[model samples]
Target: MSRRGWTLFLAMSLIWGLPYLLIKVAVADLAPVVVVFGRCAVGAALLLPWTVATGQLRPALRRWRPLLAFTVLEMTGPWLLLAYAEQSLSSSLTGLLVAAVPFVAALAARLTGDEDRLTRVRVAGMLLGLAGIVALLGLDIEGAQLLPLAAVALTVVGYATAPLVISHRLPDVSGVAASSIALFVTAVVYAPFALPRLDRLDDASGTAVLSVVVLGLVCTALALALFFALIREVGPQRALVITFLNPAVAVLLGVALLDEPFTLGLAIGLPVILLGCLLATWRSRPRGAMPVPAIDAAA
Candidate 1:
């Protein structure tokens, strides 16, 4: 990958990863629904004009049904769920759970006819990653009655479905357009609940507002742009390796910024998750897509 691709990927990793920490901060003042809605609204605000300028708006609008499904699955359902999950779970844990995306995507791709050979290397890496993931689930899955584990499982499904939606339903759509539309769709979906509390956001601190804005403009929008660029360079399969970096940043931020716990278990598990990420995206280099940036891995 070129220097720019690596730069974008690393930036995206941190951008996406930081959201977990930001959610932790935002929940201190705003409700999860409002926060999620605001994220969408702000992201859409950031991208709406470009979408219009590019003349993709009408075509995107005409494909509302699939777009709606993509929005619900990609943005609304899981983003909201992760926000809610953050109400109970830690940011580091959220990052850990999301690490399954590559594994999930690989399985989904195989099911969807990606035609990539499932080499022994890939299979070993996937399983090892899962084991590391299981190890990281320090919480007794049986005892955490609320099933934070299960909540994250659904989050994994959301992550898995996002790429499929992009490749299948919105292949013609640029990543910017798809993400912006998803944000807009998120705002629409959550409006009934979020609109009622618009005034409540006024009570939030400047930090919270800034966090939400960065989350939208930088993370979701810019990260998606970098993501697609990487996909174009390296193809989605190989470019997906950055998922590993994103979670690492989240964990690091949690420890440094949020004072999140960094137990021996977390120490053990983090490496495994990173390893899984590497394994899953290891051979994805086909040189068809644009070279990916590795700057930050929040995405």
Candidate 2:
């Protein structure tokens, strides 16, 4: 990667890594629905105008079926679940759990016919990633609530599946436009639930409010723009490597700023999960075979 690519890559790692911490902060005062709504609305507010200015809005809207599907799978479901789960789970652990996404994405891609057969290395990667998750749950958390853990698991699956929706179904759509529309729809869908809770914001702390704002403006909108640029600079496969780094940043932030524990499970599981992700996503091409197009893996 060039200097510019490295810059974007690092920017994305920091930016995307931030949401776990931000969500943990925001949900301290706001309802999970409100946090999700605020971020989506803020992100949509910025990206929608750019989509229209670029004349990509109509093209994206024309594919509303897939756009809506992408929204539910990516933003609507995962964002809320993450926020809710953070109420019980530490941001560090939550971030590490989501690191399983690549392992799930490997299977999702094969099931969706978006990739070649899963090699033995990829299968081993999946098992290793699963072991890491078990270690985190067993060692880091004491008698973890089933519901929150289930929510995180579902969030992982949703995150993994959303990219396949983009790669397979909405391949031609402008990524910015699709993301803008998805964020808009998510805001709209959650408006009823969130609007009713607007009164609650009056009692919310400045930190909580700022966290939501940052999540929307910086994490969601700006991060998406930079991620697209990163893809253009380094290509999607290289850009996807940011996924491995994000949880590390998340863990560091949680530990330093929030004083979350740097537990035995985290110390052990983080590197193991990351190694599994690296091997799981490794691609090899046969002679004369067409190169597999990389899927969008930005979280």
Candidate 3:
């Protein structure tokens, strides 16, 4: 990678990696709905004007069906579920759990015929990924953790499905417009749930408030812009290195800052999950054979 590519790469990795920590903080006081609503509202507010000014919003909005589906799949359900899961699950575990997306995406791609076949390496990756999840559950899943674990599992499916929606149904849309509109729609949909809690912020700490602001402006809006540019610069395959890095960053931040537990399961499972993700998503062929570009959870 060139100097500029490295800059975008590292920036995006950090930007995307920080969200789990921020969500954990914000949801400590705010409702999960409030956190999602705040993030979508702030991100949409910051990006809408620019998308409109650049004449990208209207063209992208024309395909309303896929756009709405993408919004719900990518932002609405996953965002809320993730935030709610964080209420019971630790931030580090939440981030590590999301690493399951690639495994699920690989299965979705193969089943949908997005790719010709799942390579032997991908099959192995999938098995390893499953083992990691099993280990995680076996180690940490007593008591109330099961519910949050199920929520996280749904989130993984949503994250995987959103990219397919974009690749198959909304491939021609502008990235900026798609992200902005999806966020706007999410904010609007969650308005009723979020609005009633607006007056409850009096007891919330400054850290909780600032975390949501950062989640909205930095993690959502700025990170998506950076992601689009990174994809353009490095291609989607290379850009996905951030995905491999983000879970590690999330775990590190959680341990270092929040003093979250780094259990044996985290120690044993994180690397295995990342290895699975790498293999499952790896391309053995020449660069030219890569499929159509698509967004990921980074969006």
Candidate 4:
């Protein structure tokens, strides 16, 4: 990767890592629906205009079926679940749990026919990853609530599956446009629930309010833009490696700012899970196959 690629890579690591902290802060006062609504609305407000101006909106709209599927999986369901889960689970724990996404994504790829095989290495990685989750749950069982943990589990599956929808079904769609429309649709869907709680914001703390703003403007909108740029710079495969770094940043921010505990489970589980993800997603090139071109961000 070039200097520019490294810069974008680092930026995305921090940007994507931030939402767990921000969501935790926002949900301290706001309803989970409100937080999700605000994030989607603000992100959509910013990106939809750009999509239209670039003429990407029409193409994205035409693929509404798959786009909506992507939206529900990626944003609508996961964001709500994350917010609700954070009400009980610490941001650090939530981030660490989500780090398992790559493990799930590896399985999802095979099931979706995006991957040709589920090799022994990947199966071993999955088992290792499952063990890490068991360690985290067993060690920190007191802190982890069953329902919220289940919510996070569902969120992980959604995050893992959504990208396959893009790679297989919406491969030619502009990522910016797909993301913009998804956010818009999510905001619209959640409006009924969120609007009723809008008055709650009047009593919310400055920190909570600012967290929502940052979640939308920085984490959702700006991060997506920079992520696309990173894909262009380093290719999608390398760009996706940011997943391994994001949870570390999330853990750091949670500990330093929120004073979230660095538990024994976290200490052990983090490394094991990350190593599992690394092995699970690793693809050895065939001896004489041509170098794969940069997969479009739609993947």
**Model 2 clashing-pair count:** 0
- What overall lDDT goes with each candidate model? 0.71, 0.77, 0.76, 0.76
> Between prediction 1 and prediction 4, which has the larger lDDT?
4
Q: Could you give candidate 1's per-residue lDDT for residues 1-299 as a string of tens digits?
A: 45655565566667777787788888778888988888888889988778889887887787777777878777888888888888777775677667677777778888888755566766676666666655654433333437666777888887776766665666566667667788887899899998998798778898887877877877777777677666655445555556666666666676787687776756886688667655655564454664223321222
TM-score of each: 0.81, 0.81, 0.80, 0.80
Q: In candidate 2, how many Å is residue 201 off? A: 1.5
lDDT of 4 by residue, 211-273 (tens): 999999999988866765665555433455566566666766767886988888668866776
Give the per-residue Cα lDDT of candidate 1 at 186: 82
For residues 1-299, what per-residue lDDT tens digits would candidate 3 score against the true structure? Answer: 55766788778867888988899889999999999999999999998987899888779889999999988888999999999899988775676677666667766776787643567886686667656655543435446567889999999888777766766787667777888998999999999999999899999999999999999999999886776666555543345446545766666666788698877866886677667656654546654666645433233
Off by over 4 Å in 2: 1-9, 116-138, 227-241, 254-283, 291-299
Query: Pairs clashing in candidate 3?
Result: none
Winner by TM-score between candidate 3 and candidate 1: 1
Alpha-carbon deviation at 164 in model 2, angstroms:
0.7
Stretches of model 1 off by over 4 angstroms after superposition: 1-7, 127-143, 254-276, 284-299
The whole-model C-alpha lDDT of candidate 4 against the native structure comes to: 0.76
Residue 27 CA error for candidate 1 (Å)? 1.3
Residue 260, model 1: lDDT of 74
- Largest lDDT belongs to which candidate? 2
